[model samples]
Target: MNNRFKAVLFGVLLVYGLMLSASFILALFVRFDWISTQSLDWLPFLISLTIMLLGGGLSGFRSSEKGWLSGVLVGVIYTVMIMLYQFLAHDVWLHDGQWLHFITFLLASISGGIIGVQLNQRND
Candidate 1:
């Protein structure tokens, strides 16, 4: 497969993997009452932002070109995957202000891609 495609796929997978890991940890914490249930409110957005950046960085480093585009692809694919899963599994539509998530995630990934490219260049 092409490096760009591979990068994008890997990036999406990485995001999902990290998300699952985060969810599992959160569940454990909640089960133990170590963190209040209210903590679930804004934690997901923060987790997504950081995880997307890491995923985008991996894609940018692997693709080594058009890092912004790779990041965008990663963000889009990841979002679509979630949407599809929710639609198919839960039969749920998006609630209000969900578009903001897409925009925020895309921007985070883009920034990460740019940083990753610079880092890759420095390592070369």
Candidate 2:
């Protein structure tokens, strides 16, 4: 409801839109034989990391303090949303193998938040 939370949500939505666009493009490429599907096996993980990083950065920029905490919260929320969607759509659940992806996302988001806070401070 607050400005910071709103910014985080906006960032998440923005990333999701970008991901959807990318997926569509990839699908087209695959359909046309321009790229092999096997090459895109890592796309989902990369997209997830990117989304969390951008979302956390936005949150940190808008928040008054506790940038790391804000980043962590954003990362967790994003992951949960993604997992829930996957579960509902594909009946998939998290497995032990996915822990690395989650950790990577969290770390990337925290790093982004730190950068955002630093940038905001510099601009002030």
Error of 1 at 123 (Å): 0.5
Worst 10 residues of 1 by lDDT: 110-119
lDDT score at residue 67, model 2, on the 0-100 scale = 75
* TM-score of each predicted structure versus truth: 0.95, 0.81
Q: How many clashing pairs in candidate 1? A: 0
Q: After superposition, how far is residue 79 of candidate 2 from its true place, in Å?
A: 0.9
- Cα RMSD (angstroms) for every candidate in the order listed: 1.0, 2.1
Lowest-lDDT window of 10 residues in candidate 2? 7-16
For lDDT, the strongest prediction is: 1
lDDT of candidate 1 over 34-119, digit per residue (tens): 99998789898899899999989988888888889889998888888888888899998776888899789988888777777778
Clashing pairs in 1: none
What lDDT tens digits, residue by residue, belong to model 2 across residues 1-124?
8867776666566656766777788789999999998898887678767767777777777774667877787777767887998899989888787777878888887877777777778889
